[model samples]
Target: MTFMKLKFGTAVLLGSLLIGACPALAEAVLHRGNSGEPQTLDPSQTSLEIEAFILKDLYEGLTSYDAAGRIVPGAAESWTVSDDGTVYTFKIHDKANWSDGTPVLAEDFVFSMRRVEDPKTAAGYANILYPIKNAEKVNKGELPVDQLGIKAIDAKTLEITLERPTPFFVELLAHQTALPVNKASFEKNGADFIKPGKLVSNGAFELAEHVQNDHLTAVKNPDYWDAANVKLDKVIFYPSEDQAAAVRRFEAGELQLVYNFSADQIERLRASHGDEVRVTAALSTYFYSFDTRIEPFKDVRVRRALSMAIDRDFLSKEIYSGAQLPAYSLIPLGIATYGEPARPDFADWSQLDREDKAIELMKEAGYGEGGKPLNIEIRYNTNPNHERVAIAVADMWKKTFGANVTLLQNDISAHYAYLKEGGKFNAARAGWTADYADAENFLAINLKKNPVFNYGRYDNPEYDALVEKSYNEKDPAARSKIMHEAEAIVLRDQPIAPMMNFGQLWLVSKKVKGWQDNGSNDHLSKYLSVEE
Candidate 1:
């Protein structure tokens, strides 16, 4: 109902243009600024937040987030959980229809569930569906794709069996990874199903054009289930990785919304645009993952020393201008269900004392000047903010540990590809935005089971066992406790050094309406309108 209430009073927009003796209405358009060029528009193939922002516009999942980031019914009109909480049944909305005028069926979701879990699909976040019975085994190639616990009970009814009692299953369903891909379109076009003419979306909008680095455009879908309530006629998403350029464009009135601008420009942007500038705490974490599969980093003392020596507080206050908060644990604070995640023992220590201890630890671990020279490379994506953060961290290591550090920069797409494809590296920058509200979503990244997300290749049998135990625990309180223990273990080992919890920054034009700040940071185009 929250989503229902967010809709504009009238779905239709009217703009008068005197055409000789008659008046014509202009098409309602929204110019949106996204972070970077998407690697792919395929929901299953994308791992970036920027891609998700657009995908949510083109695809509808069983559940979706509203303008306020609250979960709401989406493609599935209604769903019910079994008494045991291991099975879910969803009734597809009768009005749900793909862009091509085909009725959205339960079988569509069933096919998507199987494909995403199959080894052939190569979905980056395939592990997100691990809750489904035999889902993990199917993804791991131990089970057939047909073994994934999803079935079309009827044309409009879908049934899913879970491996265990998953409390966040509904929340996870709203993630972009869970969105259904039309089987007919995929089979017909092969990998090109995402092309403008081929992509058959079941959301409020459908892809109209994609101009790579320029912009991707989507026009309203007449066949959308709630088309009558959908206001925007078209939405243009610009890949604005260059924040300065994006800011200039926004100031020039070329864009109504810009995402991820330079944090240092906050004051000036706010001064110039007044209340148009926006900042909201994100349920996300930015960190550097160590290649634990390699030497030096394999040693806990060396890893801990490197992590402890870095002054996170300084980076948050100086580099990001308070746009982020110093993080000690990989999981961000204030996640629902799980409260106050465990932190490193050195978390409360003064920076001066921590640095001294770090030096001693490095020397003891056969690193630093007296021992082996710690030659390390810091890999990060090509963004001004990332470059500055990498340089600051590299400088800290050079000064404190007397280690030689090298920095490697790649574009957003290539940077993630290198890590996800299991490319060998020293230390690489990584950030995770929550796919759902669960702490397990964050902890699952470090699991040995998730190689794509677990770029560090951190394998701890005890930690993995604890996580598995939590999955089958059934009781919420007990599961939380077990997860806390597992997190404590990971923090102690420190395979990934927590840098900061993110605060998403954006610039919204005054012409834009229905923009609301949310912790999850999802502001769907369907809930927004623009006034000319």
Candidate 2:
């Protein structure tokens, strides 16, 4: 959350402005600065928030979120769940079609689901589909892809059977991973399917152009089923991780909306522009994951010491300008489903007391107090704020226990890839925004069998059992209790140091109407219109 002092390059801003200043569009064209480069355009492979911003517009899943963040029908007109609640039957909207006017059939969804389950696809988010019967087995190569419990009854009818009754299955459908992909386009284009003029999507907007780190443009899809309600003619996104650059582009009148304003500039912007500066307690947490399989971190004392040494209050106040909360658990405080947030074991300890305990624990682990110093490398994605936080945390560890901490910064995509696959870093930056408004979304990532998001490689059979049991437990109160137990175990082990809960800090032009602030931090252009 810490913002570093970085100058916005005038040349880069001008180049971006030139690309977005489309005079041909007489009515409405939205200019936005995406928070970071999209990790991937392929729906099944994408995991980053920046990618979700574009993917949600370019592809329509069975369900979608309205401007209010309420679940609504998208590709499916309606769906019915069986008495057992393990089977779902969806009635596809007859008018839904690809940007090219080809009918979007139920078969398309089946193909996409199967592809995600196929081991050959190597989709990072394929585990999201594990609720479906045989999906986990298919992903592990024990079962064939054809065994996945999704089938197209006909061109307009689709049915799916789950391993158990999943209360959040409907919400899961709204996620990009559940969206359909054109099988023909997939085979024909291979890796180039999402490129300009090569993509075929069934959403309000279709891919018009994409240039790696520079920009991604989407034009209104004429063949979209509900094109009449779509207000924007074109939306241009400039991918950037620099908060200063985003703020600069927004002030220059080149961008209508921007993400992650510098902490220092927020107060100035609020005083000058007032309501234009939007800040909401987002359902997300900014944290760090430890490589639990590695040495030093393998010891519970070392992990707990590191977690206790850093001051969460300092991070929320001094660094983020009090824009976020001091998080003590995986699930953010606002989530009512979890009842109450679980306080970490060190929550009650004063800063001095925590520092004393951290020193003692480091000694017990045979590290500090004239013993061998604990050498740890902290890796994070390239962002001014991320770098600032890393520097602060490293300093805290050095001061508290005389530990040697090295900060390694990589490109956003590369950073995540290294954490998930490279397995070389001691600790890495991590964040989780609720995919659905449930604690399960945050807690499920730590499951030992979940190959997708568990970058830390934390394994506890007892903890995993509690989480797995919560899925099938029908009683809301019972589920919450089980989840709490699982969270307590995680806090005790300290696989991740819960840093700070997120408050989305962004700027939206006052001229933009119908922009609703929601916990999801969703600002889909379909619901917005420009006054000019």
Candidate 3:
């Protein structure tokens, strides 16, 4: 009950449960709580999970994730790789059709990929397509969009040429950014196309209706290739920043599932919901980025000092109630599927030793020894747990090195927008969830030439070259070593101070079935069913 006090932003529709105007049916429906309103429905433009939740249902790419989070074929029934691994040829499913009964074709994917590479689109994840030959050039407007290495061989066949051999290219197809859009519908409707009935989809569900900041209703798409396996008749997703209110709704049976509850609520919910209260380790890192172009942060020592000063162990265990792991590296620890663990030099340091070294570094950087005490301000999105962590970090900085600290909070939408725009902040809270099961997904954000998610503006030629080398390395062991070197460069530079690794915590109804706790947090409605 104490967790009920967590305040929500104005967007959270407290107890409002409007289910659109659809007639009540005896069909199965799974009601879920989306963490927040999506910034955009355009798959190319979406950079957040809230948008991904809806887009995953609205569109299927060449491949998709299964219930166990393995990459499986979706729209493209099968694909073949050349001996060199630079070329891929896919066979589109003939039965794949959009919601409006239009046939899904190879041309659709070609158009979508070009759209992402177009500078006019300003897609945040455009760089993800850089593996395709000339994609980076096209995105930078140095080459024509048509030059991008993707072609529609025929209505049912698609061929793509990569700049280099990328082992994860097939798995990358499962990402929302790789989804195809109906070129006709997109051009005709333009900006107004994201609305409910106006959107055309080829996935398991189609947009039935949507109310901004309230709820989005998706009904099973009859035209979907595998619609027969889509057991749920409808799924309604409510977007709310109010974790407590969402939990309350889940308890009252108004909602079937809620996501990302506060650490304080976990124990209580675990006791009450038992098996329905889910927790799974996430391949994500919650960190704060510095504007490295600025004066103090421009100095690597100042950056390193501030990063080493925080007691991440204390913050994770004490403040977050052991809901997270203390992180010293940008990538989460022990994700060995991709490569060897990227261990930072300070990864094994004790809290007291780290703090002492932090002070020494600060003094060397001309601060905290009767010099101007380092002034820092941290900006983060509104969340009870985030606020607590920021406050704890601020306290740590002040106590350890006598640094002045300021805390600023913004709503979820505004917060991401501000960071994306390269807004100035001493340190800004940021997080990265894996788009695919690879270390490259996490490392790509900080690539010096990348304009997308590089909020820190961390420019290092050595780091950039190392990452590029990894992409082209033919051997897995060789590629991983290159990636490790790239990660180490950034870790030493400290453009982003590693905070804590995440574990997704969800409250589900006992009546809901087929939910799996996977690292990707990619549970699709196609696999879920509700009890009568």
Candidate 4:
């Protein structure tokens, strides 16, 4: 008990050491190995999934994800939707309080929603909130933040109106962008409120400290509305960019949960740790985006040829160790009710036929032994897995088109920031895990309206219209059909070349309880308990 209350810097160090030396001290302390350091703790300002993992514990949204990644009640005890299915009213429990013991009012949600869509705030994932009325306009600087459709009905009740009917609207609230900020703390400290000492969160845990490149610590929040049910006293997340070393740490008992270990280690891990090596199919796609705004790639033939030339089977079986399946379309299987996504004509072609056609396509695009030199610069984020994949793709490009290829690597944060901030490049690696199970979540990245996640800057009007039509369509079958059509257009245009459908390869310690494998791959620390 005494060791659990150690100060920030000292706690991360001595706690790990003391816990290892005294097994009794390790009870209720969880050391989670995260993919990388969070880019920012601010809900409105982050785009990375790693940051969402920590934010979910510190900030409860109107609706929240359960242990199974399904939508469930959170700060709002319950909510009702209008018969038209556009307006929603949420009732926050009077007992809901921030970490500082102040009541969480409905005005806080209104303020937070407005803040996230305010163009001045620059939320990278803002488009996800566009289902709310005027949210897109507000985020695009066309409308005033106050004009956003959220309203505080009373001190404890909140109402939100959507511009159009959205079936997935309730589930959308479970995203990190919908996490409310403590109005008092935010007003008092401004942007610094996300800092350790100033952040007044309302979830099961509160931020204790974040030592960059080391660990982020959160302790149980006594003031939380559901504090009585929270089992873990402290949650410490360690950024494990070097996953191999992280596996070593996991083997040494320094970390109870290690995520995204190198796939090449799957067999050895299974033999050694048994069920601790959690492997499952995930609704995620790893793809490379050709900068549609730039040349060589500006030609559709060049983009399609390069995409077809890559031997996805080799990448899946050889590089990923058969953990992932080769993907030919942006939408992966088992997403919502969208059914199977439509694939391009080349999807069923053999590798040999695809390569021969790729060569012919390259020649037609004026590359190969005659016209323009195909000097491709591929940019991928830092990770042993991503680097290996990039090198393999480079070799395939060289073999197929005799293209001069260069690979650019940057740290995770910097790499994504460069693409998101509109830095120019020829081809860049991009991966998407569905924010919701909907196909729109995957296909919407190519939408011109989504400048943040639309890294390649692709702006196809027909594709955009079909996606928008699906959102407003009432019939589920018709909506899914519209979305499927939208996916087809992107595949034909080849804005992004889908390489693989990810199989979530993770290591969850058997000692941790309440974890369920789900498509979205979100496991909240609040729902999990650490066992001795």
Candidate 5:
């Protein structure tokens, strides 16, 4: 891994002392509980906490989502769409440059997009670019990678021709998979650039230092296009896995911000600093998926019985302490096109009358209540909150369906390993955050042959057809109707049980100002001001 060491001398010592003495003059330290270690810093290959955290500091896309979740220009100053909507021409910003002062040209975008789609990269969202001409064929190795649609007209112009007119193309570019990278920097660092200090960035901040499992420090980028508006001089992120430890760090004045606090800690914090605690209902849903290819769970009735056995409202109120809202559908509220209105909720499945129905369904699936009880193991990460939720779910299943259930908890890394290998867990809990502001972002995961993000390995040709049609449909209302039908098919199958919608809680210190915790769930410390 690449590591940079500062010269050890009195100058460094004096700087440290000054930083410690004046909180406003020093970097703002933000503490958070990440469930797992970052697999890699390569924007194309990594997802989870690392991708979510690093994208804010180390990358810039042609377009970006603003605090209001609207598409805004980043490296690109302006763009034009053809009358037919198949051609997109972007005018690169004259001032954008890498941290090494190299000009960010249109070729960089082409290189980055092609690199993600390369078979060697294994990027999770590579299919996201399939709308671009030849992207799918190139990804499937049917066409050469060079044949991909993206091209550079010159140093300052990028022209993208698509096979179909994509209405959310600009919003999709804001995702990390589409972020530009410097070819020279990437080639020079080779595989080592994924580590700290070796990477080059043109975003609001640049990585200064990183200590494994301890902290990551980012300093403001002086060369950023919006440097004048960036308020923070530096940001320190502590990746503590313990929620209570994060709360203690915040209470001890070591951290200016904390998120994802435990239920008990949130209650205590609300009792004390209620005014400082901010809560926003997220467009995220936590759910459990069954590997239908596996035995027993292969039965649709058994899956529906398991779904009916769990009480979402009870879980939200008791385990989550009302911090979450019960989720009846995969798409959360506030998502524009695929919000709650676009999907059919399970009205017949209810906490009140669902338990007896669950027993009957399980019996019909060849496991009679009080007879040969169906034994199953449910798995989740080893976080305290996750364990508590899993245990509660296990108890609910046992009581309602009269089936024996076991709770299995592993560290985040081990759990992900089990998922990748398609281990024998009957069910597993997972969550997905949006990549862009579209219903397609949520619905695309169910595409029949998609290798990434479809961990359930769900294959439904009808759903896939509807998704493809919706992608090219320019009329919002017409597309939404098709998407609604697709959502109905998925819900009816019950391959996954939608649990709850997240209500993210962030504690910000009084010294921090001008920060808006937007719906995208990104924390851009550069937009925060330390009180003078």
Candidate 6:
């Protein structure tokens, strides 16, 4: 292991070398590539990909998770959890300030949370704030927005009250959707606060410039509370959809960091860079969701038959090229109560017997080998690998069940629109990366009433009750049991056919130090320093 002590002066020396020595620069350009462009820079309206990149530079919540998945202080210097577990009091860091030199006050959090739950703002992930007392009622317009439970007791102190005890509440606050915003800037700019040269940030970096769909540049924030610990002077982010081209750029020394490496590139980079090519299991599950409200799929037998006909293992190996693991359930391994090898008995749809059973079920559902082909459309985003996987599955379904399946490929924005508006498609590819280290993050979203991300509309009163019960149960063992039952219910319904667990692949230059990959695939560039 390389044991180089990091200090303020040492960081300055190394940063100088990064800017002065390498072709890309010792300044750590932090070039990143993704298939989807950042939809919005507004912390409340963006998705995970944009949020993860913006988090390094522009936002700060009360708490954050470390690389080890432990909770740590961020904007809040310290906090106290009430004995009843319903109230939390946070002390803001005295040194924290916005990029414009205004102090980041506790009232900023109050205004930010209110803005997210306000129905007019239409924050996509606003359901994440449901734990706050009366948040749901306020969001639904059943109660006034000011009735929400968060309050700024003073300039530097914030108090929050929840409807019930929630162990994951602190972790939930760490999410970008819950990050604090400057009330003054927000009121002045309204919806235009995210525009270039108009944004103010409280995180480790400040937005230097932004060119839509092309590139965004951020420089280190000198006013950040932990600015002394941040090493890089600037980070340049590029939004590119072509993974192969991104890898070419990395190989040509035009970029220093790249995410979502192609399978062929992974093999070649492993041969050359060895340990520099890193792959880790991500807390994500890619699945095919059947709109239960749509025709033909309303039948549970049809859903189960579709799930059984496809082979998850074959798709993972052939299409993913050993980049992912076959998934059997919504909750990926290593989450709460799911770390055990054999806890829940989700159906093993990959088995050979299951294939035979699927054929039988198809015949019973009035579609068989010699009957009329079950015409269906399978939708997926236009990533090279995702489209390839959809094509492979379409072929598999045609061969196994004699179902005539058509593949529809759309760009990321269009795909999201189709899912959101309930467009006509028998089935579509979808996935969820865990927001926190909880099974609730996976199973809760599928509830019938969840407005944000629940595309399938799968609902069971029994399962919903169990999810609520687990949240309040203080006993770990009891909570685990309840969550296990909830997972069983979701798998049995098969609203979504679980296909594979994602594995994140990143190609980084050897000179980048302290860039540890986490289970969530979140890259914290603030903790990284370039070495000469």
Candidate closest to the true structure, highest TM-score: 1
lDDT of 3 by residue, 132-155 (tens): 999999999999999999999999
The lDDT leader among the candidates is 1
Per-candidate TM vs. native? Answer: 0.95, 0.94, 0.93, 0.94, 0.91, 0.91
> For residues 1-532, could you state the per-residue lDDT of candidate 1 as single tens digits?
7666555423322212243334224578999999889999887888899989999999999999999999999999899999998999999999999999999999999999898988988898898899999998999899999989999999999999998888889988999899999999999999999998999999999999999899899999999999998889999999998888998999999999999888888888888889999889998999999999898999999999999999999999988889999999988887879999999999999999999999989989998988988999999998888889999999999999888999999889899998999998889999998888888988999999789999989999999999888888877888899999999999999999999999989899999998999998888999998887
lDDT of 5 by residue, 162-277 (tens): 98888878877887778876788789988887667788888888888878777777788888878888877777777656777877777777777776677645677888887667
TM-score between model 4 and native: 0.94
**lDDT-better candidate, 4 vs 5:** 4
Query: Candidate 2 at residue 469, lDDT?
Result: 92
Candidate 4 all-Cα RMSD = 5.7
Q: Judged by lDDT against the true structure, how good is candidate 5?
A: 0.76
Query: In model 2, which runs have C-alpha deviations exceeding 4 angstroms?
Result: 1-27
Worst lDDT run of 10 residues, candidate 1, spans: 8-17
> Which rank order by lDDT, best down to worst?
1, 4, 2, 3, 6, 5
Estimate the Cα RMSD of every predicted model relative to the unseen true structure: 5.9, 9.7, 9.6, 5.7, 6.1, 5.9
Residue 142 displacement (Å), model 3? 1.8
Q: How large an RMSD does model 5 have? A: 6.1
CA lDDT for candidate 2: 0.87
What is candidate 2's lDDT per residue for 324-366, written digit by digit as tens? 8888788887777777877777888898999999889889999
Q: Which portions of model 3 miss their true places by more than 4 Å?
A: 1-25, 337-339
Which pairs of residues collide in candidate 5? none
Predicted candidate 6 versus true structure: per-residue lDDT over 388-407, tens digit per residue: 78888888778888778898
Off by over 4 Å in 6: 1-28, 67-69, 337-350, 370-372
- For candidate 4, lDDT tens digit of each residue in 1-532? 5565666758689877887899656558999999899999999987788999999999999899888878999999999999998899999988999999899999999999999999888888888789899999998889899999999999999999999888788778889988999888888998899999999999999999999999999999999998999889999999999988999999998898888988888889999999999888998999999998888888899999999998999999988899999999899999658887899889999999998998898899899767688999999988888999999999999988889999999989999999999998999998998888788898889989887788889989999999888877889998888988888889988989999999987788888898898877888998899777
The order by descending TM-score is 1, 4, 2, 3, 6, 5
- Report the Cα lDDT for residue 71, model 3: 89
Q: Positional deviation of 201 in candidate 4, in angstroms?
A: 0.5
